[model samples]
Target chain A: MTGRLGFWLAHLFVLAYCGVLLAGFVVQFGADELPCPLCILQRQAMILVMCGPLYIIGRARRGDVTLADYTMGYGMSIVAAVVGAGVAARQILLHIVPPDPGYGSAVLGLHLYTWSFITFCVVLVFCGVSLIFGRELVPRGVRFGWASKVVCGLFLVIVAANLVAVFFELGFHWFLPPDPTRYETFHGLPLLGAAAMSGGAVG
Target chain B: MAILIFAVLLLAGWLTVRGSRRATVLVVWTVALCAVLAVFNHHMAAKLSLNF
Candidate 1:
């Protein structure tokens, strides 16, 4: 594994992980499942994890490839992943006991929070391996490729989506609900079909 | 709180673009760690707080 390949792989993995989170959001909206406060926090963790790759790409574009640079990115990613895992674990513990009824609708036989926990764990392993094999990921002054540009674009879109989602879920400045079940846009409107679905199964 | 979280993220993103590498990493790590602590205890905090 050459340094260039390692760099590209790490960036690609970050993009792929971003895609996974986006897909999860699609499911959440499609299934009319409202995200709980913890779920929203987990999404923020996802954004934080995504930032590592964006930082790497930014540095690579500026021709600032160094061992230290790679280490910083890896460290940021690993820390965010660990934190994300903790958030997921908290959500899992909240619902695991009796009378809680667990999380919302399951995906592929696992709850969304459960999937988040698993993904965060995978991120931990991935970042750990990337750091352990850090020698390979150092930039070699190679020009940023088309794939990197695409991934950067994807990251931007995901960030925008996150911002918009939060704005609609919680109000503009404050007013964040402990457990959000409705979009802020529909706050005062009568219960409609889509609004009904946003209630989610979990109380 | 959600807006504040986003604000912190945007600040981190900006710092990542313009600030020193160590500074950016520190910001990212701090935010993520703080989020974990907050999320883990959000329910309990809400239950106990007079203002949430």
Candidate 2:
């Protein structure tokens, strides 16, 4: 892919991911208790993910990626990937061992702890794959190290397999339960006449 | 499963970023879900209090 296309995809993913994360956080804080430690770490990975696109765009906006800026940006992503992977591993252990009861009914809604784990893994993959772009390939003497090709490749393989497993599950009709709704707020009473609600839905 | 929600893109922002014309449709959907939950939240809390 062209650099610009890659840039746009990176931007789009990170931006939307951040949006959903913030919305979920709002939903959580509005109702329940404080976020767990793993949740906070997941948010850190999110910040790291968002930072990559921001740094690139900000530098482009300013007309160039200064050597220092490029190095720092690359460094941040590398650190984030490692940290994110660690967080993911921690959450996965919790998932397997059951350290904390999921904060909410797993059948009724998404569990925040589970989400923290998944988001951590997503960020780890995003950051790790992003480093493969080699945007900050250092000069001979400056070369610190290359990202682990083997580990990154294995991660991609596992994620791809998991996605296929999801497709299989979908084929089998396994699905989360949703609550039945009683009030049809939009189509209900005289106060909710279609005329008044037409604009409401349109909005 | 929640996996379906991921595959289907729970938030429309993903669809919009993927080039959907009316991605903001998701914002309204989310707001509606939140409003319903909020209303239920109050009702459920009240009902539980009376039972107690």
Candidate 3:
């Protein structure tokens, strides 16, 4: 529960966040579901939440870990999670009525937005507890181990993938449709045109 | 655009990991603000089922 341990734990949380984001992608492709605008906003909020941990990890690597680092990191995460939770809650409410199946397929008996709400709640709890227990100042000379490096690399890759995915999703447009059906960017590409066309048909 | 927003967020994250605290903070805040605006815009444009 020491600040030092908390700092290391932050890396694991970062990895967990990455896993969640990856799961969303898996559902997107595996289930052939295109994320709606609100869904994309939730994803963006998740990414912003992860950045807080990344900030703390970066500071720890420099051997200058401090209380301010932890505060800023957890504070930013808390704020993002709150916003994400709100978005997810809104989505959940939109489908709460009877005979209304939620957006996309259910994962483990819960829709993705429902799961997102749970995740954001967990984040809030995690940050709150971490802030309370992780008060000790970590010693100097801390550096990134191999696992941390791999996690950070994975995070960067996820961010880059999102960039590409979103660009294609909103291609040539400033906003995504309420119910996105295809990658706009791929509408004209020979290889992906048919896929995009098929997706458009679904809409 | 959503692409530009994510791009900026990615840059901010990268900068944070690279130890550019001030720049990262500024960029993250900017992205957060933009995201809020985009969310509002989406709500305004979309026809929601919610009564409230």
Candidate 4:
């Protein structure tokens, strides 16, 4: 696989990540299900995993793509996916009992975290395959065309949205509840006040 | 705060797409470190019923 091929592949990877993030959002607002702290961590890992491809694309635009760049990109992605998979797995195990109904609603018969685990596994395979085949020298001066910009822009918007969502979910609190029921910032409830009122420890 | 962390990650990503090779490398590593730390912190703070 030539460097140019790898660069385009990176673009596709970015778009795929964007789609996944968007789907998560759809579930959040569309289903009125608030993500728990673990779910948020999984999302964070997804963002971190996507960063690998963004790094590769950025370097390619500078006309300085290298084998090490591909390696590093794939390596970072693998590490992030591993962490994400672990989190998703933990969540799955938490509600694995036969009588337990699982957290939140299931999408296509599998919970969001289950989908996340599957996505991470796919990412691991994708990165590993790309690494094996992507050994050719990358040509310099690869264009950072409009399509790439649009994809990156979409990714930026998604990240920004996540930032806003997290702030609202956490409010002035340093930590979110293990299971968040409402947007603390939106309700204008201070973390201490909410905790005191509920007679529950601040999460 | 998670918001602050995401903001930093967003900034890094923005700087990355602006065509800075140095920023791309830095952001990748920074994000990786942050993801690990965030997960570790969540495990420490949130009560879970896992035994392993």
* Model 1, span A41-141: residue lDDT tens: 78888878877766766677667578887777777778788878877887787678777777687788888899989988888888788788877767675
For model 2, report DockQ. 0.06
Q: Candidate 3 residues A54-86, lDDT tens each? A: 888877666777777778888888988988898
> Which parts of model 2 are misplaced by more than 4 Å?
A65-75, A98-100, A105-110, A133-203, B1-52
Q: Against the true structure, candidate 2 has what lDDT?
A: 0.42
Best-first order by TM-score: 3, 4, 1, 2
Candidate 3 wrongly placed segments (more than 4 Å): A137-141, A190-203, B49-52
| Candidate 1 CAPRI level | acceptable
Clash count, one per candidate: 0, 2, 0, 0
Worst 10 residues of 4 chain A by lDDT: A134-143
True contact recovery of candidate 3: 0.48
Q: List the lowest-lDDT window of 10 residues for candidate 1 chain A.
A: A171-180
What is candidate 3's CAPRI-style docking category based on DockQ?
A: medium
Superior by DockQ: candidate 2 or candidate 4: 4
> What DockQ, on C-alphas, does every prediction get?
0.33, 0.06, 0.59, 0.57
In model 2 chain A, the worst 10-residue window by lDDT is: A138-147
Ranking by DockQ: 3, 4, 1, 2
Report the poorest 10 consecutive residues by lDDT, candidate 3 chain B.
B43-52
Deviation in angstroms for A52 in model 2? 2.4
For each candidate, what is chain B's TM-score?
0.53, 0.49, 0.53, 0.54
TM-score of chain A of 3: 0.89
Best by TM-score: 3
Write candidate 4's Cα lDDT for A38-121 as tens digits: 888888888888888887777757677777777777888898898889888888888898989999999899989999999999
